[model samples]
Target: MGNQPSVPQPGTPLQVIGAGLSRTGTASFSEALRILLHGPVYHGGTQLTLAASSEIRPLMDIVSRFPPQNASEKKLIGNLLKQRLDGYAAVTDAPFNGLIEELVEAYPNAMVICTTRDAESWVKSMKSIQNAVTMGFLRFILFPIPGMRHFPDFVDLMRKQWWYLYEAGEPLVAETYYKHIDYLKRVVPEDRLAFVDVKGGWGPLCKALGKEVPRDVEFPRINDSQAIDRLAKRMVQEGLKRWSIGFATVGVVLMSYVFWK
Candidate 1:
């Protein structure tokens, strides 16, 4: 053999890749499939980077300067993930193809599972995540700022960037997601593409993936819109009260200054 690559033997369990929004049931699917297939499962696992402190450090604010599909960068990320999942029977929720093609390419024999949900729901989930991140930033700033205080200018720049992205980024992300899903579908063939809606029932999904339904497979439903709407209305009412108080205080201060002068 002249540096020939080895192929997976018959009956080796497939590799499952869960791609999509944060709350889209990747974890649930992975767990269910793992039990059904009788394989080792790794979920959303990340390798430590120099930028990510091993201590009580905050999340790394990656300024993705390039689109995820940049071959070389994708290769590096893929290699890192491949190394992490070396002995694992399957992996899931490991970012999109742009960020993970290398890992997929390396394990060509494994099944490539890509999951997606409704676009509107995906956008909402993304919005919720961004809002949480923004709130976290505000809380950190109120606490005299965390990583940003070290560089005031950088913080200001970051805030501006975040605002711009948060407002304008969703459509772009949605477009990219659509394209990536299409790409995976075209490339991986029907047998490998585990096209599934997390909202869907577990029995059919298990059948599609060549696995027996787990006796106790519990698919946890989350991110209901009705619940979010109630929370939003409550926040708005509180906001209006705060605004009213501010207006009253400003009016009193101006009136006092005029009378004294």
Candidate 2:
């Protein structure tokens, strides 16, 4: 199929497209972008996890059709994501990392930055996040909530995007990273593509985006493992709280039924 809508939809404001996976210092990079862009950014996985019920449902359907099979499929995915991302300055992190090519082509002018870290270190961090996700099972915990019933589909979407790494193991995870890097190098033009290893601090990123390095602001170093764990715990608490409300409502209904009976 032809490139996925190379021209941005009319009046679209997105200026950056991130083709980086989680644990590639993506959290820190995202925070940095927030500082630089002075606008909202569509952070990939986290947004999907916490999106409104109305949004989560459509997002689930869209993501489940990954690796778009045809040009039309590509447009469908691109148009929907663009609609969601229209107002944002940029997007970074998981699932979207899998859509790097499409996004690169979709918004030809957007700066494409691939967040990078030492491969071994990145894979180790990735495994920790994977454990947090799998053992914690955020989807299962939240499934009972009417609003979050489609959570499993979101998980499935991530799984499909990272099938090579998730289904296999670390060796493949490292391999996948390199392969992605190679893809970026091959497909993305030199002028627009930037590789930011956040550990190196803000200089590299600042220079890439044509923004002077901020002497006052300390570069963010968000440990995603800790962040993800906290998120899972919060979601679990929310789920249980919702279940309690549902039970209380049912109890009230049952009491009324008995009284009327």
Best by TM-score: 2
lDDT of 1 by residue, 83-105 (tens): 44555566664233333344457
Which stretches of candidate 1 lie above 4 Å from their native place? 1-14, 45-76, 94-97, 136-168, 171-177, 220-261
- In model 2, state the lDDT of residue 221: 75
* Model 1 whole-model lDDT (C-alpha atoms): 0.48
Worst 10 residues of 1 by lDDT: 47-56
Model 1 residue 211 distance off true place after TM-score fit, in angstroms: 1.1
Error of 2 at 207 (Å): 1.7
lDDT of 2 by residue, 12-119 (tens): 477888887677877778778777877666776656555555656666666777778899998888887777677778888767777776787778789999988887
Ten-residue region with minimum lDDT total, candidate 2: 1-10
Cα miss at 89, model 1 (Å)? 3.2
